[model samples]
Target chain A: MNARAEFHDPATRAHLLADKARWVREQTLAIHRRAPETRVASSLSAVELLTVLYYSGIARITPDEPLHAERDRIIISKGHGSICMYPILADCGYFPMAALETVCKPGSFLGGIPDPIIPGYETINGSLGHGLGVGSGTALALRTKGKAQRTFVLLGDGELNEGAVWEALMFAAHHQLKNLIAMVDCNGRQMLGYTDSVVNLNPLDAKFAAFGWQTHTVEDGHDVAQLLAGFEALLASDSPKPKVLIANTLKGKGVASLENAPLAHVMGVGRAEIDAILGDGAAP
Target chain B: MKTTMRDTFLATVLEEMQASPDVVLLSADFGAPAIDAIRAEFSDRFVNVGIAEQNLINLATGFALEGFRVIGYAIAPFITMRCFEQIRVSLAILSQLRPMNVTLVGVGAGFSYDVSGPTHHCIEDLAVMSALPNLSVYSLSDHTQAPLFAKHCLAKPGIKYLRFDAKPHEPVCDAGNDGLIERGFRVLNAGRDLAIVSTGYMSHVAWSLLPELRAEGIDPLLIDLVAYNCVDTAALEAELAHVPRTLLLQEAVLDRSIENTLRRMAGGKLEAMGVGDRYIFEIGSRDQIHDAAGIGRAQVLDRILQHHAALA
Candidate 1:
């Protein structure tokens, strides 16, 4: 009904984010149970991060006025993995809550990969290595337009392997895009297996720091308290360098069968386990 | 008359950026001498995206969405092939949902980068760019057309690909009062029996054959198709109805080339005068490559004479 900014008392914010994260986790799973086409594991990884952005009102988006020029821009590069946004965007009033039931269905704006047609989404996602560059462009435009809006982008750590991401990182740092904040959901597992075993991006922070970005890391990305702290730091940042937070998260955060599994990226939850998780025989 | 398409294109871009604050020019570290002026004059808007075409398209999409007209310039081969998906997803599809005014300025059309080897020859740009949905393809023929299209593109929206030659070409005819310049296609010379149609550098070769054809008592019509895929097909069809025979010349492969377009519009094979499906692995001049691909002037002239004699 109103602006839901996260600049609240520390204790209250922690408790509120903790409760909201749990609710988002359930809603995300429920949506996946219905759609079945959504990437549940990757979506689960970014639940808290996206939950904090919308529920805490850190993103400066008015659902009714989603295209407000003064609002901060959030470009989610990992579209297929960010299905958590379906429930979050609906809850934020970008669309109706009923739309979540029709995700990946005929005539649903909510597809397997979130598109800009869905309100609250900026640039097109799903394709990797695009968010940072586009966000940097948005940030540059904001400065040129003399508007005070900031640009925030969410990318996957595995996406770091893309050469274009590095190209954008170099450009962002060279331009000193202080108003741009890019956070990587550092869920170790990519589609195939663990990123370390795949391409090995261990010194991510050092890489960003070396590229001249102000870098930070949360030991527990799923912790609402630490996640909020990282967002707060970037929001309050006055540094010339663009800031990046490598939020260390698990691939499949909540589900017992999925979490930390080698093949969690493509693992779909069966109907019985869905009923067990929600404690209801009713279809999502 | 003596400048490359890159110079004229960059010069026009500089002018566009000067007149409007919303026009942003970006490059993937590919630059010309004229680009230096643009970079110096509009340093804030002129960004070198570093040798990365994928990033170039992504940034252009974002900039266009934010109410800025963007131009992403790079070598034709690299930008079109390296970032094909980026262009398809970000620019081509996004433009359908929103008003996107992003123009991709790809230099080195055809074998303009002749010495750069197969890696640099952009013979495939025309085929691939035209295949994308909701895209306007302009295979420009001369330096004059680049600035002309540059002026026109500043006011246009959606995704446009200006396939420019790396080399400069003198005007076969004065382009100032040319109605065909804006009409997408122009009949340079009129004849009853046959017509020669071409785009980019091949147009120059087509223009050169006028005297040769006249000597043979054949003053065939010459049609310069500047806007390839976006050309007015109905109008071209009407023009073709008047001519008994047509020869479509290009530097790209025959598949998805202008001849295929003509076949769809005019309802007959007009003798595809272009390269066929195969790589020119052998290094040579532009003419040598054209000869190897069987689209050389001599080859084209032989085919045209044969068609004219058959029609007679």
Candidate 2:
């Protein structure tokens, strides 16, 4: 596989994006099929972001070999999104794709959240608001070593409430770390209710701006073109501060019945729901 | 006791950094005087994470994850209790295969910072550190012991909590000698009428009172317990067997350190000498708190004589 061939042309990029999105859905469905009891719905939107990065973005990863040093780092700060990340890692070839079947099993590495001991996971994170700090350190290490590798961290909108996250943001911005990019999965809804109802981070762009970060917001997170464009714009900028790509997305994006349904935050898809999402005649 | 222990600790850390380029020193914004020395000596290996205890631990963990041997330095409470979760998760669990060393200095073992109030007093640090599974806790008795134990901690793989008083302590053991490091030594031998088990800076006071006790025909044995967590239980039991009464002296609270030791040697009659259960209400020097806690040399000697006389 020529590394450049995955995203050489616009047409190819689009096809890869669609294929990765489908793969994300299929993998998510597989997680549900394997562990019928696990809560795997809160992070459906994470699948889109993981797919976009792994399949078409700059991370140099071979699914079979996730620990490759030169590969870009993807730290999922929103650890609840493990449901989305584990399958992508399996697809990337970190583990036997079938091992995902043991997710949340009695004694399996694949628990309800990410564990670094598992082949591709970088940091064992289930607690929110820790990824950026770890990522900052990794980015700093890379800079000190003069490595060209970049670090991409996925943070949940709910996690912004934590003061440690902002402390990390300020630290990254003060250091002017251009090699690091932080993406906030702005799904609006949290466990209790909408983000507005909880703490109302209405002007997130200005907040990032105030913190000395180069900030951008996407209206449609599911739009691969926009996601890629935002990433490209970030890569092109020579801004001394770190970048924050605010991806505004629906809670449950792909399946029509589950789209914008807050109940999907904790609800799992059964055989009937899975069939309905895949199509009426789809196999269980 | 002076500032030799601080100097020795800093010097040994610099030496370790020179040998292993991967060694990084993270301070919770303390020890600025040593900064120029470290920078002039080992430039790339030092980071002063300002006052953020949680960030300090996480950053160290991050460095450890990047294959660097990180040493997080701070006063006891800040390093151990403040960012405990980070220590437990990041350094303890993440670096379990080759665990990073986080050396907590300036632990107010029995009111080292008597005037800094309850917050600065690290009385329960031993209890807190001992509870952690993969961590080794050491309370250095004097300045000479600091460097020796530090070198061992740096070379060995795991989390180690090192508690030391900031000021210089009386030379309980010779700096050139490695006897204390290899085997836990009895600095003062008084034929076992009574034994005083001392840790950290208070061991000096315990040793100092031995001559007075011997003059009074109260033979008090002085045992310097260097490594608190890995204490030789058999040796302790043997020492307890000869003495009719044992006095556990510390600079911290009496309950956990002394009480736990006594509980372990159930047969021995133990009297704990240290700070009372309540926080020190009045502000004064370290000596004042030691006096208040009744762990000072005079207080310890009086208690020992009284206990021994009662048994006779």
Give the candidate number with the greatest DockQ.
1
| Model 1 C-alpha lDDT per residue in residues A165-272, reported as the tens digit of each score | 887898889888898999999999888999999999989899899999998898899998888888888778778999998899998888888996899999988777
Clash pairs for candidate 1: none
List the lowest-lDDT window of 10 residues for candidate 1 chain B.
B276-285
Q: What iRMS does model 1 reach?
A: 12.9
Query: Which numbered prediction scores highest in TM-score against the true structure?
Result: 1
Q: What is the DockQ of each candidate?
A: 0.24, 0.13
Residue pairs in clash, model 2? A63-A92, A63-A93, A63-A94, A64-A93, B1-B168, B1-B169, B2-B168, B110-B251, B110-B252
Tell me the tens digit of each residue's lDDT in model 2 across A1-284.
Answer: 63334564776786778677777777787677666655555567766666777767556675556667777877888887558777777766678777777776644667776667677677756777778887887777677667888888999898888777776787788778888899999888777778888899989999999989999898888787788888878889987789989999887666565565666667666677676666643443
Task: Put down candidate 2 lDDT per residue, B102-153, tens digits, no spaces.
Answer: 5555445657777888888888888777666667778887777778877887
TM-score of B-chain for each predicted structure, in order:
0.81, 0.76
Off by over 4 Å in 2: A2-9, A62-64, A255-264, A279-284, B40-43, B97-110, B173-191, B232-246, B254-312
- Roughly what TM-score does model 1 have, to 2 decimal places? 0.89
Q: lDDT by residue for model 1 over B143-178, one digit each (tens)?
A: 777787887787888889988888766776763426
